[model samples]
Every structure is written in structure tokens, then in C-alpha cells.
Target: MTVALPSILLVLLFALNLPVAFAIAISALSFFFLADGLPLDIFFQKMVAATESYPLLAVPFFVLAGSLMNAAGITRRLLHLADALVGHLTGALAQACTVLATLLGGLTASSSADAAMLSKLFGPEMLRRGYSAAFAAAITSSAAIITALIPPGIGLIIYGYLADVSVGRLFLAGVVPGLLLAGSLFLTTWWIARRRGYRPTRPHFAGWGEVGRAAKEAVWALLIPVFIILGLRYGIFTTTEAGAITVLITLLIGALVYRELSWAKLPGVLRETVLDTSSVMLLICAASAFGFYLAWERLPPAMASWMVGLTRDPQMLLLLINVLLIVLGTAVEGTAALIILTPIFVPVILQFGIDPVQFGIVLVTNLTIAGITPPVGQMMFISCAVLRVPMEVYTVEILPFLAAMTAVLLLITFLPGLSLWLPDLVMGP
Candidate 1:
């Protein structure tokens, strides 16, 4: 009976078009009552436990920080700086969209938010520049996914909490793979631009004077992620406190430094932050109870034992896990997948001597790619809406980018050092 809960609950909730959070909670409650012999009160208890953590506070603060940065004009400035740097490249504006998305993602950590923002800011520019609407939508959506792997990423936060890994380390672990994905996507854009005769964004490179000016304007925007990582590394703050500090820093930049984030705009930012944070936290709380059901059934151990019987080799195990995540990602939200699946897989991977940090990067990277895949891809839908591109057109245009991202994912998976070396070098054993 316990063994049937994960699948049965999934089908039931999915059939009803329930929100993912409620689906998780209802399924978990069903299991608690039917098979686990647990009290109904455990559901509320787990909710309290899920919300009680200090680190969990980061969710709202970071969500708010991302909002504040947008309000403060940081996002606009970052776009200017990115355009100045890459705007001379072939397909320059498209590439700038990617770069700017990556930069703002560092602050926002939510791919959906990043994609929505880019759609508004860069979506029109791409259309004006003669890039096909479909291509622009595809690139914007795909580019925003780079944020999901960067430090302060909400996906990493969920993975950290569910798997009991250090949120800070997971944050650090994401840096290289995130940048690699960005570079690979850029190259793909260049190739497509050259083949399609996309015009260069600028006739001549901006001078040092312009570059310096853009960078100066964007400085405050750039330091938020760096401050979070350093604070966590030095024990100046936990991930939770760092989030509060992120809000403080963003307010200062928006209110004091930029002066663009006016008092009148405060309510809108707060409203959006609450909506986003509530959606995410509700999922976490629900996932916690669902996770408890899995534990109660002893599913992880059973699955781990079965997997070991199939293959004791670490690489084979990783390949299987990656394949599973890709399929799961198409149907499930990335955070939901990470919370539900990481526990089941991570222990199995560790048993085969795989580095948890390396696996974490590979895991998140695969899910990042999933965000752009079809049939319920949240980012894909967001991009299509923003650029007003038809699904079939954008899907075809996005293939090359997907292939490039896949290559990077495989590289990180096999070359464990790429993901782990920096973390080890900077953070030590």
C-alpha cells in the first residue's frame, strides 16, 4: 500500500488539474491515512516543520530581492552593460538577451521571472532587430534557464533542503556549469545568426568609455550574488540571513543609489514577491509532507537496493538518473522533481562513489534544460506569450540551443572536476 502512494497520488492529483502544491499535499495525506498509519495531524506538523527552518526564509527574501532589483533599475542597467559588451557580435541583440538574462537570474533565481522580464525588455528589441519572433522567444526562454543553475537559485535551494545538503555549497557548485551553459548557448546563437543572415546589433564596438560607463552603472547589480556566497563561506550569515541581507542591499540600491525604485512602486513589488514566494513556499511545505510519506514507506532503500542490483557502476547510475530527470522535468516542475527525486537518487549515487556535488550540478542542469521542453514547459509558455510566437516555430528554433545545452550537461556529468573543482579550490574539503 505504501509502495503505491507516489504513483497513485500523482495520477489522481494530475487528473484533477490541481496545483502542484495541493497535489503533493493531498497525495501525502492520503498515504499517511491509508498506508503509513500516521495521524492526520502529522500533515500540519510537517507544514510547521517545513516553514520553521531558518534557511527557508531565504526563499521570500531572495524573491523580494529579485523584485527590488528590477524596481531599482538594476535589470535595465545590466541589459545596457550586456548590450555594450555583446551588442557587436553577430546576432548581438539575441546574445545580449541571453547575457542579460543570465545576469539578472543571479539576482532573481527564478527562470520564469527572468524569462518574463526578458520578454518585456528584450522581446521587443529582438523583434525590432529582424530576428524572427519564434527565434527570439526561444532564445529568451532558453537563456533565462541559465539563472536556475546559478548561485541563489531557487532550484538549488529546494535541492539543498530536501537532500540535506548545504545550500551555500550547492550555490557555489552551480557557478561553472551555469557559465558553461551560457557560453554554449551564445555559440549556438552565433551559428544560427550566421546561417540565417541575422544582422549585427552594432556596426562598431563600443569604446572603453562607453563600456566603463555601462559597467559602472551596473556595479551594484552585479555584487548581490557575490555577497551571498562570501557571506555564507565566511560564516558571516547563513543562507537565510543572506536572503534578508539581499533584500536590504536591493532596497539600498533601488532607493538610495538608483533612486528609480520609488515609494509608489513598493506595493507592486511586494505584491509580486508575495505571490511568487507563496507559490514556492507552498510547494516546499507540500513536498516536505510528501517526502515524509516516501520515507515512511522505506522507498529510498528499496529503490537503492534494486538499482544497485542493476548496476554498481557510478557512471551508469548517473546516466539512468539523468534520463529519469529529463522525463520527469517535461511533466513536473523542476523544484518539485528535485524535492521528490533527489532523495531517492542521491543516496544511490553516493553508494556508487559519485560525488554528491557533481551529481547535484548534473541533476539541476538537466532540469534546467527541461524548462524549455514542450507540453507544460513553464518557461516555454512564458516565452511564447511574450514574443507572441507560435509553438511549432519556436520549438524548431530552440533545437540547436537544446543540443548545445545537452552537450554541456554531458560534459559536466562525465567531467566531475568541472563542477567540483572550483568549490573545492575555494571552499576546501
Candidate 2:
């Protein structure tokens, strides 16, 4: 009966539409109080144990760094560069939106943040340029999903910690999949823009001179992943340290390099970072307690046995897991899904010889894709808010983008080599 407390509270909180972090915490608290066999002190112990992790240090640093980058005007410069590069192509504005999102996603870990920033910057312009408001909203929301598959991705970080995989490797594994998704969205945008007759903003290609100028402006912002991977691989720092370094570097770039960081802006950055980090950290703390409860209830073992009984073949198991993840992604927050499912699925995936880092990519991709979906999709809501478009309108317009994303997800799911090769090559074994 004590073991059941966590699950019961989980259901009750979820039904009440409580925040994911609070739900997990409340459930864990219920278990602590209701379980006669278990001591309440264990909950406190587990909470300490959960946060004592060395790798977990990366969470705050990365969040802070991402916030700093946004403040530094890296996102704005990157968007300008992306616009210059893609604005001459077919469906120029639409493709530019995708390109800019991909670039910004690399710098920022939050999809909602990316969506809000991009939509605010480009939404009105898209409408004025003859793109439908719904289409603009759809593109903004869909493009932001790529953020979760890029390095420094919060979703991937949470997944790595939950699944007990190396967060560094997960960061590297995300590279190929992120590019694939970006490319697919680019093509989809082109096709749709052609059909819609969206006009190009630029008349011709920007020469190397212009490209170099743009790259120069964005160079500091672009080196973030390079620094993180190198630092992690060479033992210069752990993932957590890398995240802290990212924040420091981003601040330097914003204040010293870009000359944009001001005293006034500092307060806002701190405030926003505090809010963002608080939300994510709470989720982690709650997940810690809930994870213990899951083990107490023998959920992982039961799930493993059930999965194995359903299908012993690795390919079939992968397929089933992918389908389930995709479905869950639509309804649950990506971070929540990662926390809950990572513990349950890691053992089963390892049993089938699936690469944990590769699976992390697949999992994050599916969840990000779901952000464009209807009903509970946060990205959908953010995009709509930015563009002031109705949900019904954006849903119809976003189908092509969704199809493209699904294709990318399937590719990553079936072809592990695509995700693994880059990590193995760069990180080496």
C-alpha cells in the first residue's frame, strides 16, 4: 500500500493538471508519508543523493549560459546571417525562419524560449510579407522543436541524467539528428512556400564577403558547442562545468564582445534565468523522489518483463518504443516524458543493445515534434501567442512541417548509425 502511494498521487496530480514538477514531488511526498514499511528519512536522503550528482551541475550553468546568449544578441546576429544566406532561395522567408531557428536552437536549450523570441522577431514581418498568419505561427513553432536536439539541450540533459547515460555523449549524438531535422524542415518550407508564392527578400546570393561578415558577427555565438564538446572530451571540465563555462563565455561575448550587455538588461536576464532554472530544477528534484518510488514499486522490472514478453526482437522493440514515445510526446511535456520514461525504458533498451545516446536523440526528437501538435503542445501555444493566430488555423498549416519532422524521427529511429557515427568519430569510442 505504501508503494502504491506514489502512483496514486501521480494520477491524482496529473488529473488535476498540476505542473509536472509539483506532480512528481507531491506523489513522492505521498509515498513518504503513506508507506508504513519505508522511513520518511529515506526521502530526504534520496533528495540529497539525487542532487549530489556531479553531472547535474551542468543544468544550472547551461540554463544560465543560454539566457546570457539571448541577452548578448547572439540570436539576433544569427538570424540576420541566416536571413542573408537563405533569403534568395524559394520560399525565402519560410526557409529563413527554419534556418534561423536551427541556428538559435544551438544556442538556446528551451523550445518555448526559441519560439517566443523568433515569433516576436519575425512573425509580424512574415504577415506583412504575404505569408499567412497561420503558416507563420506553424513555422515558428515547428522550427523551435529543433532546439531540443541540439547541444546544450535541456531535454537531452534531463534524459541523460535520468537514463544514467553520459551527458557528453548525448550532446555529441544530437548533432546529426538536429541537422537532419533542420534540413528536412528547410525542404518542406521551400515546397510549401513555392505553392504559396511567398516572395524572396533578397535578389541574389550573398557573396563570401557578406558571408564572412555575418559569420564574424556570429562567431562568438557559434563556438558554444565547440567549447562544450572539447571541454567535455579533453577532461577540461565535466558537462556541468561546460555549462558554467558556457554562461561565463556567453556573458563575456554579450558584454565585452557585442557591447550590448547593460546594467539594466542584467536584472532581466537574472530574473528570467531564475524563473527558468527554478522550474527545471524543481522538476529534477521531484523526479528524484518519484524515481525512488518507482523502484520501490518494481515498475521498471514489471515494465521490462512486459516489454520483453510483447517482443523479443530488437527491431520490433525499437519500433514499439518509438511509437509509444511519439504518442506520449503528443500529450506530455517533453521533459516530463524524459524523466518518467527514461528510468522505465533504459533497461529494456540496453537489453536490446540499443545505444543509449542514439536513443536519447530519437526520444528528444519525437518529443520536440510533438510540441507542434494540438491540445497540450506548449510550442503550439507559444507560436500562436506570438503570431496571434487561432489553433485551428495553425494546425492545418503545420501538417507539412509535421510530416517532415516525422520523416526525420523515423530516420533517426531506424538508422542508429546516423546519430552514433558522429559521436563515435569525434568523441572516439
Candidate 3:
């Protein structure tokens, strides 16, 4: 009754449109009060302890770095480079948007931020070029999914912290899969554009000199991710330190090199960072309390045993897990889902001899796809709001991109090498 009551309260609260963090925290508190002899003091301890993590510091640093990059005009430079590189392809603007998302994925970790930025940056132009609002929204929302798989990804950092996996290795492990997803999205965009006869943004291929010029302009912004990977691989810094270093570097580039991030802009960037960090940390605190309840009740082991009995084969187990994640993802916010479910799923996957790193990528990717899906998809809502497109229109247009991403997810799930190859080569197992 103790377990069922809390779970039911969580669902009921969610249905009533309460904030996720509050819902989780309230439900968890109920567990303490309802459970016979369970102490309430432990709840306070868990919530406080959850916010005291060093590794978790990466979230705010990375988020602030991204905000600084925006203030510094780094994103504009990268978009120009993406345009010079892929602006002649079919659905040229769409292709460049996807490329831009892939590149920014390294710099920024938030999918919704990427979607909102891209929608504003390219959504109007795509519409002016005769592209449907639905198509524009679909492409922008779906392309942002790439951000979740790329290095310095907030999702990867959180998963690494929660699952006891290596953040540096998870960063390296994401490279191939991230690029592969970009390629898949690129092809899907091209095929759809070709079929619909959507005109390319550029009349001709950009000259090499033009591409070179754009690259030169964006070189400092481009080097951010390169420096992060090298720094982590060579032991120059720990993951938390990497985030701090990234912010320092971005501030330098913005203030000194780009000359766009002014002293006046610094306060706003810090304010935004505080807000983003607070929201994430609060959710983490709430989830920690709920996770504590689950641990106290010994739910993970029971769930793991049940899963093992249901499927002894690793492949089948992975497939089943993916389906559940996708469904849950469609309903829950990705970060909330990650925090609440990782404890439950990690134990089961380990019993099947699954690599936690690979599972982390698969888990992050599946939830990312859900962010663009229907009903409760945050990315979908952001894109639709930006483009002024209806929900039904956005849902229909996102299907192909969704399928393409799903294909990549299945490939990563079945072929562990895709996720592990870079990590093994760079850091070893």
C-alpha cells in the first residue's frame, strides 16, 4: 500500500498539471508518512545530499557556457559556416539547420534551446522559401535530438553521474552515434525535399574561399568541443573542471575575440544561468527523494528479477526496454524521466551484461526522440509555438524524421560497437 499510494499520487498530481518537481517531491514525502516506521528525517537528508554533488556541477557550467556563446555571437558564426558548407543541397536551409544543430550540440546541451534557436533563426526563412510551416517545425524539433547524443551533452553528464559511468568516455562514445544521426536526418531531409521539389537556398555551391572564410570566422567557436574532448582525454581536467574551463574559454572568446558579449550582457547571462541551473537542480533534488523511497522499498531488485525472468536474452530485453522508454518519454519530460527511471533500469541491464555507457546513450537517445513526439513533447511544443503551426500539423510532418532517428536508436542498441568504438580507441574499456 505504501508503494502503490505514492506512485498513484504521482500520476494523479501529474494529471492535475502540477509542476514535475513538486509532484515528485510530494509523492515521495507521502511514502515516508504512509510507510510503517519510516522516518521523515531521511527525506530531508536525501534532498539535501542530492544537491551536494560535485559531478552535477557540470550542468550549470555547461548551461552558462552555452548562454555566453549565444551572447557572444558564436551561434551566428556557426550557422554561417553551416550555410557555406551545405547551403546548396536540396532543402538547403533545412540541411544547414540540421548541421548547425549537430555543431551546436557540442556547445549547448539542451534540446529545447536548440529547437527554439533554430526555429527563430531559420523558421522564417524556410517559410519565405515556400516550405510548409509543418515541415520547418518538424525539421527543427527533430534535428535538436542530435544535441542529446553529442559530447558535453547535459543528458550524458547526468546519466554518467547517476549510473556511475565515466563522463569523459560517455562524451567520446557519443561522437559516432551523434554524427550518424546527423547523416540520417540529412538524408531524410534531402529525400523529402527532392520529392516535394523544395528549392535549395543556394543557387550554386559555395566557393572554397567562401567556405574557408566562414570556417575562419567560426574557428574559435568550433574549437570549444575539440578542446573539451582533448582536455578530457589527456587528463587536463575532470568532467566538472571541463565545464568550468569551457565557461572560461567561451567568456574569453566572446569578450575578447568576438567582441560581442559586452560587460552589460554579463549580468543577463548569469541571471539566465541561475534560472536554468535552479530548475535542473530542483528536479534532481525531488527525484533523489523519490529514488530514495524506491531504494528503501527495494523496488529495483524486484523489478530486475522480474525482467530477468521475462527475458533471459539480452537482445530481447533491450528491445523491450526501448519500447517502454519511448512510451514513458512521450509522456514525461526527458530529464525527469532519466532521473526517476535510471535507478530502476540500470540494475536490470547490468544483470544482462549490458554496458552501462552504451545503455546510457540508447536511453538518452530514446528520451530525446520522445521530446519531439506528441501530447507532452516539450520540443514539439516549442517548435510549434515558434512556427505558429498547429500540433496536428507538426505531428504528421515529424514522422519521417522520427523514423530515421528510431532506426539509429535500434542500430546503437543492437550494435554496441557504434557507441563504444570511440571510447575504446581513445580511453579503452
Candidate 4:
């Protein structure tokens, strides 16, 4: 009952509209305050101690790196690359949005950031192309989920940090799953375009000259993942050091090569980075205290046993967990839920002999889809607000894309090799 107190308080606090970090902090501190043997100071200590992790430094560096790259006009170059690659396809502008999200995934690794940027960039263009406001909003928002699966994604970093998995391996493992998502969305868009009689943005495919020109301009942004992965695989840098290096690389490209990000832009980027980093750091700290309470109650292994008892089949267990996460996602924000759930579920998966690396991909991808889902999806609201689309219309238009997303989700869930092969091959098992 005492252990359950925090869980109950957590749900109640969320229901009462408390902010996520504070809710978690209060719930966790209450457990320490109420329990006879537990020291209340330990709760405070855990919050401070969580920030001391060496791996956690990746969060801010990557955040700053992403901000600097954006200010440097990488998004425009990526948009051009997307256009050259897919602008001849049916529903080409919409298709470019999908491809751009994939390319931006490599650059930003942020679903929300991509969704907002794409919506503003493509929303007006799609409107001019005679596309429905809702369809435009749906594609932009749903495609952004791919960012969470790509290397250097903030979600991947947090999951890897909390799950005690290699961020490097996680980075490699994510590629195939991310591609699966992009391919599925591509096929789904093509099918929908054919039915709607939508035409490609470009009348014909880009010639080699056009392709080469665009890729050349965007080569620096494209090299980011390659640099990070190779650096990690060859022992060139630790994950934290990789982030620091990434910041340096982007700074040079932004300031010197692109010449888009200027000195005056530095303060704005720093401010945004500080705000973004603070929110993620605060969540991690609060989750640390709450996590300590869970450990004291011995909940993870207990829940792991209970869940395994419900079914010994690992595949079936994954399906069940996927359902639970999807339902939970509509209510809580993905990042907060991810922090809260990773500790509880990591033990459960290990008991089934499932790879933590694979689970990290699944967990982050699943929660990322939440940001596009209804009832409380942040991306949904952002896209809708920017495009001025109605929620009801956006909800309906998002279904087909959601189906495509779910298809890829199930594929990666069942096919461990899909998520595991690259990491195992490149970084070794």
C-alpha cells in the first residue's frame, strides 16, 4: 500500500492538471516522507545525483547542436534535397514533406520541431496545390515521428541513458526501423495520391545534375549521423564527446560554410537550448526520485513477474505492452511517460530475454507516435494551429497515416533482426 501511494498520487496529480516534473517530484517525495524507514533526504539526493551522469551531457550538447544547425539554414537545404529526390512522385510536395522529415530526422532528431517546421513550410504550399488543409496537416505531423527513430534523436538518447543501453548501438539499431517508417509512409502517400488524383510537384524526375547539385549543398548535414556513428564505432569519442564534437562541427558549418547562422543569432539559439535542456533535465531529475521509490518497493521485478505470468510468449507480451503504451500515450506526454515507464519495463523485457537495444527502439518509436495521436498529441495541436485546420478534420485525415505507422510499428516489434541487425553488425553484439 505504501509503495502504491506514489503511483496513485502520480495519476491523481496528472489528473488534477499538475505539471509533469512537479507531479513526479511531489509523488516521489511523499513516499519518502511517509515511509518510516526511508530517509526524506534521499529523495532530494536522487534528484541531484541524477544530473551527475556523464552520459546525460549528450542531451544539452545535441540540443544546442540542433538549434545551431536550424539557424544555419540546413532545413532549406534539406528541403531542396527532398524535392530533388521525390518531387516527381504523385502528390510530390506532400511526398517531399515525408522525405524532408526523414532527412531532418538525421539533422534535428526531434519530432515536434520537425512537425512545426514542416507544417509552416509546406502548409502554404499545399494550400496552393489544392490539397485539403487536414491532409496537409496530417502528413506533416505523422511523418515527424520518424525523427524520433533516427540517430542522435533526443528521445533515443534519453531512452539509452535510462535503459543502460549503448547510445551508439541504439543509434545504429534505429536506422532500419526509421526507414521502415519512411517507406511505409511513402507507399501510403502514393496510394492516397493516386486515389485523390493528386499530381507531383515536379512534372518529371530530377536529372543527375539537379540531384548532384542538391546533395552537394546538403552533404554537411547528411554527414552528421555518419560522423557520430563512425566515431562511436571506432572508439574515436564517447557518446558525450560525440555530442560535443557534433556541436563543434555544426558551429563551423553554420558560421563559416553556410554563413547563414550569424553572431546575432547566437543568443536566440542559446536561449532556446537552455529552455529545451532545462525541461528535459528537470524531467530526468524528478523521474530519478520517483524511480528510487519504485526500487524501494521492488515494483519493477514484481511487475515483470506478474506480466510474464500473464503470458510466457514474448511476442504476445510485446503486443500487450504496445497496446498499453498506445493507450497511455493519449493521456500523458511522450517524454514524461517515457521517463516514468523505462525503469519499470526494462526489467520486464530482460526477463523475457529480449534485447534492451531493440526495446529502446520500440519504446521510443511507440511514444513518438503518441505525439501525433489524438486526445492530447502535441504535434497534432502544433500542426493544426499552424495550418489552421480543425481538430475533427485533422483526426479523420490522420487515420490512414496512423495505419501506415502501426504497420511499421508491428513489423519492428516482431522482427528483432530489423532493429538489431545493423547495431550487431556495425558495433558487434
How well does each candidate superpose onto the true structure, as a TM-score? 0.96, 0.95, 0.98, 0.97
Clashes of 4: 0
What would the per-residue lDDT of candidate 4 be over residues 61-80, giving only the tens digit for each residue? 98888888889998899899
Candidate 4: segments with Cα more than 4 A from true spot: none
State which candidate, 2 or 4, has the greater lDDT: 4
lDDT of 4: 0.90
Worst 10 residues of 1 by lDDT: 29-38
* Candidate closest to the true structure, highest lDDT: 3
Writing each residue's lDDT as its tens digit, candidate 2 over 119-226 gives 887889988989899988988888888888778888888888788888888888888888998999888888888888898898898877888899899988887788
lDDT of every predicted structure (CA atoms)? 0.85, 0.83, 0.91, 0.90
Where in model 2 is the C-alpha error above 4 Å? 1-12, 44-49
Q: How well does candidate 2 match the true structure in TM-score terms?
A: 0.95
Q: Considering lDDT, where higher is better, how would the candidates rank from best to worst?
A: 3, 4, 1, 2
Judging by TM-score against the true structure, name the best candidate.
Answer: 3
lDDT by residue (230-309, candidate 1, tens digit) is: 88888999888898888998898888898998999999999999999998888888888888887877889989999999
- Please say which candidate is ahead in lDDT: 2 or 3: 3
